[model samples]
Target: MVRILQQKQFVGHEIHGKSHKYYPLITKETYTKSFMKGFVRRYFSGSYRQMVSFFTKEDNLSLHELEQLLKELKDKNS
Candidate 1:
């Protein structure tokens, strides 16, 4: 864990005379986006559309659910 933190350049503060407090070098949003990009690349060939299609079909999404999803997408884009 120390090695990983060092490699990732995370800042660590020595506490008392024994342990250390570690802080992330990256923000949570940055880390989550990075993780999701790798996950989608590995599982969905880097295609978000393909991932969403797979999930919709696998879950047997109803027309209303699909429409809701479409509305969400439209709202996000707009």
Candidate 2:
């Protein structure tokens, strides 16, 4: 837990006596987006299409699942 606190930028803590209280410094969505962007940049050369293609081919993501994901993206954009 101490190691995680040291690594994370979006976590804040308070110390009272021997006890500690931790809170988020950012929203879950913000953290996820930042983490995923870094992951994709590091592993996929910053290409979202390359990331999706790798998952669909190597991870054996079904066509139906791919269509569902596309629908969700479209819905979000709309």
**lDDT against the true structure, each candidate:** 0.82, 0.87
lDDT of 2: 0.87
Clash number for model 1? Answer: 0
- The sequence of per-residue lDDT tens digits that candidate 1 reaches over residues 9-61 is 65455566686676667778987898899999999999998888887889877
- Per-prediction TM-score: 0.66, 0.76
- In angstroms, give how far residue 34 of model 2 lies from its true place: 0.5
Q: What is the Å distance of residue 75 in model 1 from its true position?
A: 1.6
Q: Write down the RMSD of candidate 1 (Cα, Å).
A: 2.9
The per-prediction tally of clashing pairs is 0, 0
Q: Clash pairs of candidate 2? A: none
For 1-78, candidate 2 gives per-residue lDDT tens digits of 765854776677889999988888889899789999999999999999999999998877889989998999999999
Give the number of the best model, judged by lDDT: 2
* Superposed model 2: Cα runs more than 4 Å off: 1-7, 76-78
